[model samples]
Target: MFMCRGDVDSQLCHECIGNATQHLSSECSLSKQASIWYNECTVRYSNDSFFSVVDMMPGFYMCNTANFSNTKSFTPLLFSTMNLTADEAASDKKKFATNERVFEFQTLYCLAQCTSDLSSKVCGTCLRSAIKQLQIHCDGKLGGRFLYPSCNVRYELYPFYRSINVPSPNELAPQTKDSISKQDSRFLEDPFYLSYNCSSNHNTITSKNFNLLLSYLVSNATAGKLYHRVIMDEIVYGLFMCRGDLPSRLCVQCVTNAKDRIFSMCLSSSEGIIWYSHCLLRYSSQYFFPNIAETSPMYRDINITNHFISDQNLFTSTLSNQLSELANATGNSDERYMINSLKLNDIQTLYTLEQCTPYLSPQECISCLNDMISTQIPWSFLGSVGGRIIYPNCNMRFELFQFYIESDEARSSRNPSKEAGELFAQIGFILFL
Candidate 1:
């Protein structure tokens, strides 16, 4: 068996593969055949013949078992998403792809993979077979996975693969210079807007929010920020956030550029959010809190074990309680999440994190958090815990392990100007008292 990182970039693939080869041999000493998979790559070697030729003998097919309401519509959408993703993977040297398609407002996440060694035709064939196997096993279910010797495909209601790099839709769509200028003019005229009436005179902006938004924007806008512009309207407000790890100037530039791009795309819509692994973009005409909305659309790669938790009830209760506490504590605070580990038994630990946006009221945060926990706890998420609840004003996410950067580093990297703004607000409040 062989397992490689789903997000391995072309430059680092060979290095990861080499590391996996060495590690697998040492870790599985008694077993002549073993496979180790990473988020960035995979490696496996078996004493038995398991290369070049596709092997379906020891494969598994699992699905949600609940059939789609409209098979005809779902089937075509599924096929299209698969085809698009395959074309992308085939063209790219990494041998991986991630894509999402919508059916009746439901998002379907699909990931396809072929061994780096396979020819395009062979890769296509292997993926097709793997997909067919999923249909046989999962039938009408909302999610399924098919794994074979040479290739694999997985489809789920939520994203599974992490950090797939693909060209944006705007890149593929043709636009003349005149059209581009017109679009830019329209975007600048009426950009996304949000209204946050200051509840108190002492209320001030925090560097944390600016930092989060800036880092998120930079990661998405790798080209540069000078080409982009920020547009604020009366009815709707737009804020683009990049990953927190980026350089300060780069983060600002990324956010600026993304705001321009987002304005161009969503100028007509009243509410929308588009997020990349590195940045998050949000715009809303109405206050959207304590209300369920899918504004910020983002994806991450997650590798769940095939094994199920030994004690389902205990795990569920523990996770739920932790989430509730986090929600209550994170209200209107820059540090909105917490991650820690608990020893389950001698060999296993339940590592978890609970996070919410800093803008939400405590009650609003808890309600939103509970809704997310309810959806994920009931599902058999490959023995892994993962879920994301997107709202207009705030969002909440939790997993069994640490998937995001720690809060300390995130806080330290805030904009100095924004930090001063927060400090000023605090001082004003003390003076008022």
Candidate 2:
């Protein structure tokens, strides 16, 4: 596989890739695996295929010799900037992103890129692991970069690449090795993949049957089914559940994107799960419908770089109480999903969303959520502007902004004070005193 830094022009990207490949082949002729990183690109070859999988071995690191004097403030700014860049790269179809932040008087330029073959979740995870390397080896440095086979991260005190002229819709077409195919550039622009898990064991028959089931699920999604499951013999089962609030069009788009990426994302693992912001899709060798899913592969994310609560104790208790209400509401609702907004103050409004695999029994749904709330919440970041714990069975998220589209009823009751009052009436909630 080959990848170029996001800012490199197409002609430059091609030239660098060609040079790296020539040098690596001659220098490591006898080796089974070899990789070369140039200033603008990376070229890698392995005896076994490694597309879409995150790999950290055989890595390299570089940093500026100088150190920053303002480590205290720069630390947080660095974390915030890199994280923002990583999120954008992971969500983009090109699997590339850049960011610029002004900290005090100095400007920080950041870039993150993943191999095009990686799913957004895997890409984000890969970049994050690479980011950790910065802290370990290059702490207090003015600039640094981590280079790996699957992804690379770089940050500097000055601009190191092309100008980040914001691209319009027409310019988004993939035109180089550094971009995704034109077919992928559509539909996938919006649904941000969150996480994924897959079993290593692969079965030929199971994979074949699972593909058929996936087609079925996609068909149902096109037909506007909010949730659907199929048992394709005793060896393969598949299902998909769109977030309750999304329109049928977005649901179909996210489900289709998942189908296209799941096999490659899992490295052809027969049983796999992929989560996008708009939908969740999973398939397994054993039937798992109507059962409380094991939370072994749960994922959590926190917006630590964003705003944090001023009153930690009060916000903690309030958030806990709000999530509990959402859990209860989701468990008992027909859709197995709930969204709520609680006004913390004029400047801060806490929005929460909770959902389960629709087929689960109400009790099972609540149990799954309660378990996550008690054991998995990122308490250290609980006072941050946003955070979430996601399990295969259920997931709960809390952010300072509303992340979902409001329904007709919510629009009708848009009065701020009335909405706050109705929150208590509907969920039997009490004001945080």
Candidate 3:
């Protein structure tokens, strides 16, 4: 397989491929499987089947000689910028993306790409892996890159990529740090397709009924319904729920993305569900409406900040109080959604958001949130500064800094200012495989 970076012009791509073919054959001629990455293109050939699959091994890492003047200030910026860029690359038609972030006295350029043969869902996962690996090998470096058979990521202080492809941050007026973080989170939310799942069963008889159930969902989505549920022929049950604080446009986008992704991920299964940053779509052969049973966590993430909490007991105690307030507060709302913030210590403020499916009663929602506090908090966080847990009926997230907005910020968002905070804000994501 041979592939060019999306931004590379056809002529340059042709030259790069020619050079790669010659170099790979001469250097690794005896090997049945070999990969080469040039400035403009990547080429790989394997004896085994690899197309459309994620191949992560036999990778390389590059780090520049220079180091950042302030690793403390640069860590979060690098994390969020690379994350957004990875998401964009996965969703783009070319399976490639580039972005710019204004470092204090300099500009940071980033590029991410995946082989076009991979699906958007897998592409996102691959690029995220590349980012983590790059950070592991090149923390605080001024420039770095990770190259794999299926995906790659690079960041530099200089414009190492074509300028025409990336949007210029210089054109915009200066933004405060808080505003910049909000913009980053907004960018993060756009291509934030997380994952999709389903039960491990397939039935030819129920497939037709499931299609009909999806049609009902499509009609609701067309009519701009943020929440809807329907039962079809007593065989298939389906529903979709958008985050209550989202605008109609984003709710529509989230639902549409989920629908498109679900068909790709779980079409043959009797039960299917896709989760995004702002919306969730699900269908099942079993009836689960208006129920609040405790289910295992479908997905979880922890932002690891080394030595963040001086007192583990106090940290857990403080977090418990905040989560209780958040659950009680959200449980009172008709929307069944709420945003909250409480200063855990002088070190940092803990910001949290919680929500349950609207069909559930407030009491049921509270019960669900209570279960989250009791079961998830101890097993998941592990003294981390940030964490999130997603279940079938409810989800919640908390961070040392604000990671959400009261409303969608597509054109309109806030980021709390950070006075003095700890370093190393790398977040780890785990799906129940």
Candidate lDDT values, in order: 0.48, 0.69, 0.67
Better of 1 and 2 by TM-score: 2
Which is the leading candidate under lDDT?
2
Deviation (Å) of 334 in candidate 2: 1.5
> Candidate 1: TM-score?
0.37
10-124: candidate 2 lDDT, tens digit per residue: 8657766676666666677777777777657777787878876888776688655456788999888997899899999999999999887766544577889999999999999
Worst 10 residues of 2 by lDDT: 424-433
* Model 1 spans > 4 angstroms off: 1-3, 9-28, 36-41, 48-51, 62-72, 87-92, 164-433
How far off is residue 370 in model 3, in Å? 1.4
lDDT of 1 by residue, 128-163 (tens): 777777767776666666665566787765444433
Report the Cα lDDT for residue 35, model 1: 50
Point out the higher-scoring one by lDDT: 2 or 3.
2
Q: List the candidates' TM-scores in order.
A: 0.37, 0.51, 0.48
